[model samples]
Target: MTNKPTILIIYTGGTIGMIKDYSTNALKAFDFSQIVQKIPELQQLNCTIKSISFKEPIDSSNMNTSYYVAIAEMIENNYDTFDGFVVLTGSDTMSYIASALSFMLENLTKPIIFTGSQLPIGDLRTDAKENLITSIEIAAARKNGQPIICEVCLYFEYKLYRGNRTTKISAEHFEAFASMNYPPLAESGVHLNFNEHHLYVPKNYQKKLIVRKKLETNVVILKLFPGITQAVVASILSIKNLKGVVLETYGAGNAPNEQWFLTLLKNAIKKGIKIINVTQCSGGSVILGHYDTSVGLKEIGVIGGLDITTETAIAKLMYLLSENLSDDEFSSYFNKSMRGELTNR
Candidate 1:
């Protein structure tokens, strides 16, 4: 084997891996076998590169638990062989996919850097080259013969954010992601300046990585809006096989103090449905019992999801639900930052 750090580039399908035919002008997937030739800049990096792709590349809309499990297994299978991994996928559902992987893998000792571009690789002003090259460099970065980033992260634009804490805030710009709750772990500029203070280091790096493949998918996002009727709320809570709900609430997890709303949530919790309160705003934390409106939620056992995006809330719920944790265990774990997803006040 080689002595240089080895980075496995996983192309899971996205605009970043596409090119346009000169004659037909139709965009098509680029053959990653020629990745080195396609992006000659990679040859300059101090790392050995390898690549693998899905048998059938899928768009982000079609991303699901099956693919999440497949990606997790692939990393698990190659955990010992590679020093780091760079995963590329569509930006549309990247937050969800990245958040899911954050919970799926445990005790990570190497970087799992997720990145994608808003434009195709072959476009004149495409952002793909920088994102891809920087991600590889970040993944391969090490200190004292050990990896620097030991958790899942998404590198976009010029910032690197914790995977579970990121959200896609832009649909048309190269800067497509934002992590409101936490500062960026690294920023790319003249030099790759990493905020070493913010990096995640596992409690014990020697612990064998644990793969949590079982994620309960019977979950729904119930966003609250003015004029939302009791009928809509009732219908959702009454969904067959529904086990978890990501309740997107107003500022600070405030909900209408109306009797109908509180009673419905209370009844659902009594029926064993796990409902979590996450703020709808891009930033800030949920402080239950801070306001009169949220007092009922706290008393009714609606778990408070402090500083977690709806994407992370859903993933955390799915992961905890599959653990068969008791009511107390579920609430305890959900409120705390299991993988730097949230902050406890």
Candidate 2:
């Protein structure tokens, strides 16, 4: 008899776990223990399903570093016992959480598929069942006794994207997330078509999974705009304990060429503060030296964020800042792709 793969479902809380009380028209948390009974189709999968939910469900908007650490530790402690993990989180912050986990859980050898739904699971037209069922199946999928997906990924609306690459695109549609900078790792249709070329390959499966809990939250996002003021820029740069900044610049990483603007950034860099220049656009890499406006930014030692989403940028900055890397090392590592969060230029 074949030993069934054990899949662990960690419910961190979200719309997927909600059920509408039709009598009162109120929403309530559904018991995860009754998941198999609620979705009987799960019984058909060739896996032993188990689940654990947060004692107090965390609203998606309340997601923070603590929750990220908790989720990482949960998987780390259960690393040996489970073949795969399925995480349920709110769609609004799924990308951010997923991205953080991708960096936090190092050298993961089994699938960690993060999924959530747009509507309540008990809704007449809810997309929860299919997403939940498919995610578990994907996690349990293996070939030659080896797990197929060995990295963090987001599965939603029939598409499986690299978790760090995902961004929530729509609230009104079932397709809630998009990974514009990268291709889908897999797609759910009549058959689950796995895209072998786009999946992340673990460099060392023999290495034990390391959970990084220390994250530096002294970071901010300075999104550039048409009428951004010098005082505003100065105040942000002057923030006490600010270690890093994700500079969301205009197209192709262009920013104002004003002397004061350049001087502020230069001074910030001199103060041992690291700045990353990522494009505000949903698609395309930050072409730092491609235009004249961005020349000063590049000259001032701002690290170019090539095709990284704002959410991933924030999470990556937090993770990298906690590493205690030298300024030069931080710059070098930030530009390079660590955990597939950004493109390596």
Candidate 3:
């Protein structure tokens, strides 16, 4: 009875916190301070629950770096006071926010789960109640008095997924996200089932949290297509002060073998720009040299993104560039799985 966990819920605005006003027919934010009153299921969990909401909630579309920094700061300031945290954000940009937070917080030893509903909490058919209830349960899950989910994750539609490995794939269905290359960490059925073997186990539990704040935004994504022009390629690669490029190549990292195109990429690398090769397909890895087209990209110094999602690749490049690492160190760290963002070969 002395080991009951304390979980903190941070509401940063989303459909989950809204209720309809009958006369106006408009949605309004609900007070989370009365969360237990609205969702009576929370009282059943064997944990003390507390909540915090943004003073002015913004839509997921408005989420950005500043918001991420603020979330990180809040967790850091209250790290020792709470055993676990659940973040409520809109599904539209949940992957981006969750992935960024996974990278921002290093050596995390407690659960930081993100969840949101597709419908308003007050709607008769809303999915908010279940999502909110289970997200807190997952956050409070522990083993041998230690947090079981000691990493960042997203729970929606009865499935729990690794945060950085996820991407939103639907707008009209309850299953709005999918991890094409990875499996769900946990699933909620008649009984909550966790894939214990797949969980991340940290090596050092006593390490202090390392917060990365200097993320660079001067990166661009160039998706490959048939008949892409050399001039267009050169122009994009030559953006002023460009530090990195996420080249979305064809199957298994294939790209044009044309001299001008290869020359353009080679020139960028020579000028200290870090170019990462990622596959254009939704569910495969970029294996440089697996084909002739991509071989030249590898020869020209492009780093392989290795099955990382485009969203994660972009965020990872920005994070790495912000660290101001040297060209060699940048390439090394970018290819490594710092936040379970990439699959190790």
Candidate 4:
């Protein structure tokens, strides 16, 4: 028999980490350090597991870059000591956090899987146990003495997805996330199956992991709709200290060609505000010159987001801005697919 792999679980606060007390009828944090005792089934896996939890869990709504950095630092400090990591976070912000981590960690050669549950672990009908168990198994999976999953990924409802390409589509369902533009990397059933062709094959497995800490959060999304007024556009563009805007344009990245709207966008671009044109449609890509309406956006210096989800666009902008790239460099980098976040047109 092969020696058991060692996996580390980082519990960053979410429904999956809580248990309901029968006496108090209240949900409380379950100590994961006592994991084997809490879930004896884990003993069946051919792996040794360790866990760490935040002192006080922060709600997913309040999650930000600092928390991402903290998680990265944890992995960095224990880089040589652990075989893999499984992160537990709230479903509400899982895509955003997972996407950001995909960009923050460069040259990653180990599996960094994120998973969570819709119901608390203590609930009778909770899906937490399955998600937690499977996530750990995936993290512990290896081939030829190297990890199988070398990129940041999310596992929910039996499917594994590239972190940056996922979006949460439901809050109440067991399957809360969907990669609208990408295919699942792997699927679980009676037998675990991996789509090897779709998985990322890193060029250098020996490259050291580089964690990027600085991230600029001065980005906003402006979803366009029928009868959007100039005043509303002006106000959002005028937000103090705004650095980037993800313009959710109509189908195929079309927008109203009203002179007032174009004028405001031009002014923002001139003021060094980076504008990314993304399609409002759930599945299609943003083609800048697809129609006369969007041609104007292309003319006004708006970079095409090119099939990137809003969550990824926001995180990519934050990572780029943190690097203090010049206006031209920012525009150039946003148009390029750095972490497979967007499709190349």
All models, RMSD in angstroms: 1.0, 1.2, 1.5, 1.5
TM-score on alpha carbons, each prediction? 0.98, 0.98, 0.96, 0.97
Indicate the worst ten consecutive residues by lDDT in candidate 1. 1-10
Q: Residue 268 in candidate 3 has what lDDT?
A: 94
Q: Against the true structure, candidate 2 has what lDDT?
A: 0.92
Error of 4 at 94 (Å): 0.5
Q: Count the backbone clashes (under 3 Å) in each candidate.
A: 0, 0, 0, 0
Model 2 lDDT at residue 190: 96
Ranking, lDDT, top scorer first:
1, 2, 3, 4
C-alpha lDDT score of every prediction, in listed order: 0.93, 0.92, 0.90, 0.90
lDDT of 3: 0.90
Model 2 lowest lDDT segment of ten: 1-10
lDDT of 2 by residue, 121-203 (tens): 99999999999999999999987777889999999999999999989999889988999899999999999999998888777
Best of the candidates, lDDT: 1
Q: How close is candidate 1 to the true structure, as a TM-score?
A: 0.98
Task: Give me the overall lDDT of model 4.
Answer: 0.90
